[model samples]
Target: MSHAHDHDPTVPREALIAIAAVLLAVMGLAGAVRLGIVPQSANPELSRAAANVAPAQQRNLRFADREDGAVLVTDADTGETVKVIGFGEGGFARATMRRMAKRRMHEGIGPLPPFTLTRWQNGALSLSDPQTGETAEIHGFGADHSATFAEMLEGARS
Candidate 1:
């Protein structure tokens, strides 16, 4: 005589509950990070590099875009026109003006007054909107293409 036995493999109820709890905790943590409730860590090297960077040599360039599609690059100290970047002109200044307009529209803001671009003593290039009192830092100040705007500003002073 022979007896046959059958068995089924199954996870314990406790294990299933534990797994669900872990998943929920992970999701909650992710949501917190996405909502900026938890601040992210910064790279130490980048922070050091930023701190050690030299100040910008030219720090007086300011720019303003008019309602009539004209861009005026000026000196911040003297308020003199550095250059007149005309509409449809293919240049960095014009491109920057267009970008500013697009950003304003995206933010659901109305007409924007002139903005000022200044290179700070700490080598930070900033663009400030007078209307909204908003300032944005430009990271690509010393790049080759950015030389056009810098050159224009320098030329205007002379």
Candidate 2:
């Protein structure tokens, strides 16, 4: 037989199966994202999902406001600030004041974990738990002056 006549006409079935598997995985993940099942930075709003279910009086605790490009959201009943994060800069990031809280939690700062916070009209800060929906009292100054950031997941019951 001539050398050119020896070429195989069929591709291995293994290669075709592998390509199909990869495509399926990508599509499955995309579906989960659209259904609000997968959490990503692009979906920081996912945290809000956990914030729902507050009593009627506490329902107001969701997204509060958008100052400049930053968003103010937190649990309402306890008045703990959930996320004083930005929605405009690089998608979203912790606000300067909130970042200060992380850095100053120990230097005359407020309690760590089990503490969510909110700013009142009188300028007083209220602390809350992301899990229990309960709140504690706190002073707003130094690191405590920072926006309410949950110290840890242990703070949030869920």
Output the number of the lDDT-best candidate: 1
lDDT of 1 by residue, 51-136 (tens): 77533444355556778777777766666777877776736556665677677778776552445565444544556566555555
Put down candidate 2 lDDT per residue, 27-146, tens digits, no spaces.
Answer: 999988888798555422233346552321112334433657666655544667655555653231244334434444445545333334444333333444454444433333344433
Error of 2 at 29 (Å): 0.5
Each candidate structure's count of clashing pairs: 0, 6
For model 2, give the 10-residue run with minimal summed lDDT. 53-62
> Where does candidate 1 stray beyond 4 Å?
1-35, 38-70, 75-79, 86-91, 102-113, 152-158
What clash pairs does model 1 have?
A: none
10 residues in a row with least lDDT, candidate 1 = 149-158
Give the Å shift of residue 124 in candidate 1: 3.3
Q: What are the root-mean-square deviations of the candidates from the true structure over C-alphas?
A: 9.1, 15.3
State in Å the error of residue 149, model 1.
3.3
